[model samples]
Target: MSKLILVLNCGSSSLKGAVLNTENSEVLLSCLGEKLGLPDAYITFKVDGQKEKVDLSAQPDHTGAVGAMLDKLKAMGLDSQVGAIGHRVVSGGELYSDSVLINDDVIAAIEKCIPLAPLHNPANLLGIRAAQNIFEGLPNVAVFDTAFHQTMPEHAYTYAVPRKLYRDLGLRRYGFHGTSYRFVSEEAARFLGKDVHNLRLVVAHLGNGASVAAIKNGQSVDTSMGITPLEGLVMGTRAGDIDASVYEFLADNLNLSVKEITNLLNKQSGLLGISELSSDCRTIEEESLNGHAGAILALEIFSYRLAKYVASMAVAAGGIDALVFTGGIGENSDIIRTKVLNYCEFLGMNVDAEANLAARFGNAGIITTADSKVVSVVIPTNEELMIAQDTARLSGL
Candidate 1:
């Protein structure tokens, strides 16, 4: 069988795929389908650094978009070379500790996790089903974001809710961004020339959806996200770590229903809510540079909360040996990194200003002084590559 593993990330309005040669770490092809189910839906294919945009207005659903992607691969003579399919699923609940080859039972388990990740699991299920239908004999694998964090201790996962509720409903903390954390943490250990199982790491995965994980002895000891993605660090649109009673408070004060309150918190809050502008971090950073008050506050709050979470993760790890940054914002925002490190002076991280500034835009390196108590580095996350590797291993490649 060919070693080319096709990795798929299915979101509510978008689907992204990349075919990677697992043996050589080369990306043979990549494509993205966006605005699915909308009139202006389209898919973009990138080959040899050249991009081709294909209009998908007539076939504006996930199935059609996925079909287009497969057909495009066939046109490029890469369809038969793909050995296995890897899917990025947001939540596998407590059912999976690692990636699994997709089967009917696996699909049912993922379906059972719909309540845990309503915005994600349905789309992922659709992608898995679509791939299975089209690929026929190809092995499809489910690589869950929550799987890597499954090693979190019981105390860290258990909520202080009713025992019966947890027993009956599986109510517990299931942190996300596990794939990113696993990749970055291992990369950090490799950089330090130490075994990953011997290092204590606190990783900040700051993308549109953000979370922090405390990894101890190569396992997740604790994390920021709880039963849902909302109970973690402040994100692009999520109001993370809010008091549960805020729901009732809003219902009474604003005469809003539970559904309306949920939408407001999950979709209308976070950076956009605070800045009263775009949720894009680049936009906020640029406006902050221009002295826009809302943008300034948004940036400040973002870094401040992230610093606080880093401190919390350090404590959970019994004090961290190194701090790793990944994801879009963590890897690119030098301003945010500087602000976060300034707040974390107590950690004795002597951040090299020049090094931090130079570690943006896909650059990866240490950003702290050689003698600093804690090592800080930016490691760009490649969840797709991680998923592809998992697919390769589980598919007997």
Candidate 2:
């Protein structure tokens, strides 16, 4: 049956929505719904070869942005047949291992996880609730970003904290970006014409937010991000890994509160913190070429840390057979990819410089020589499609 699935990836600052036709596997409508500069916000719908941007002045908050998103879709003739609205919830904790129909209980459970992903879960709930209110009879499903990593073993997920804290507070390594990692990993296997269960892969998802996963035998044996997305590689604004005592020291010396420290780690660190310039990698790359020392340092730290983590994850999985790069920075930044691959030569990574340089954005291909020991692939991530496919399968749309 033909089905229309609307995928919603809600974040602390913006809502990214896409309408996909499962029958032909085409995108009908896709947009970035952003609320910025005021209580009034806007939604830009880019789909089906058409671009429409609407200014929604003063409608309160994220719910308002989502409402604007629906209004625009309806105006663009995509509202009536939407089979399901698939939401990407950041931290599903240990509750959900896959996508399911969103009900009141599911909503409550997601809300309960807000403390774990304070900046994300609330916005995700807003998107879900707004869709329920606007779309009415359609089934709204929750596809968790953490669900795919639930297969991670206890040894990889356990923290060395007090047992009570882990037992009582559910403090463990619940990885994020599971949807992206799952899609890219499967794509890597397809590109190699190999069964997923037969491949050991290290997928580097580099964007404003970055994470690495060690996928062995088609399952996530270990991933970089832990408990929250803040624990992985340096991100646009997040601090990846810092000394545990840094938080305490900030609280005592800087007179910061726990909430303040959390905000600092989640919003003020990473590339922005190290470069003291911009969070966007493209911007940093440009500035570094222009002799910006901070930008150079940020790029070095980001790529070196990525290499270090990829190597570590390889150890977690015994050894990696392939290194797959996805996400924005992973696909477009050839210089960064080259630098990362150079550092990974110990794993027998041999870059085909011509192939790496000739690669274009949005296309996947081998970036390593045919004789390279560890195959290197640049596979673009398609999280929206993954979310839509899961939503359709689960909703039977």
Instruction: Judging by TM-score against the true structure, name the best candidate.
Output: 1
The lDDT of model 1 is 0.90
Clashes of each: 0, 1
Please give the lDDT score for candidate 2.
0.87
lDDT (Cα atoms) of all candidates against the true structure: 0.90, 0.87
Provide TM-scores for the models: 0.98, 0.95
User: In candidate 1, which residue ranges exceed 4 Å CA deviation?
Assistant: none
- Lowest lDDT 10-residue stretch of candidate 2: 33-42
Please write out the lDDT profile of model 1 over residues 1-397, one tens digit for every residue. 3668988899888999899988887888899999988999999999999999988987887877778888988998878888889999999999999999999999999999999999999999988987887777999999998999899888999999998988999999999999888888888888779899999899999988989999999999999998889888888988898899999999999999998998998888999999999899999999999999999999999889999999999888998898898999999998999999889988988889999999999999899888888889998988888999999999988
Tens digits of per-residue lDDT for model 2, 1-397 = 3668988887766778888987787887888867643666777888767888877676645667767777776787766777888999998899998888888899989988998888789989878887887778888889899998999999999999888998899999999889998899998999899899988999999999999999998888899999888898989999898898998899899999988998998889999999999999999999999999999999999999999999999998889899999999999998899999999988899889999986648878899988889999999999998999989988887
In candidate 1, which residue pairs get closer than 3 Å at backbone N, Cα or C atoms, i.e. clash?
none
Model 2, C-alpha of 210: deviation from truth (Å): 0.4
| Residue 254, model 2, lDDT | 95
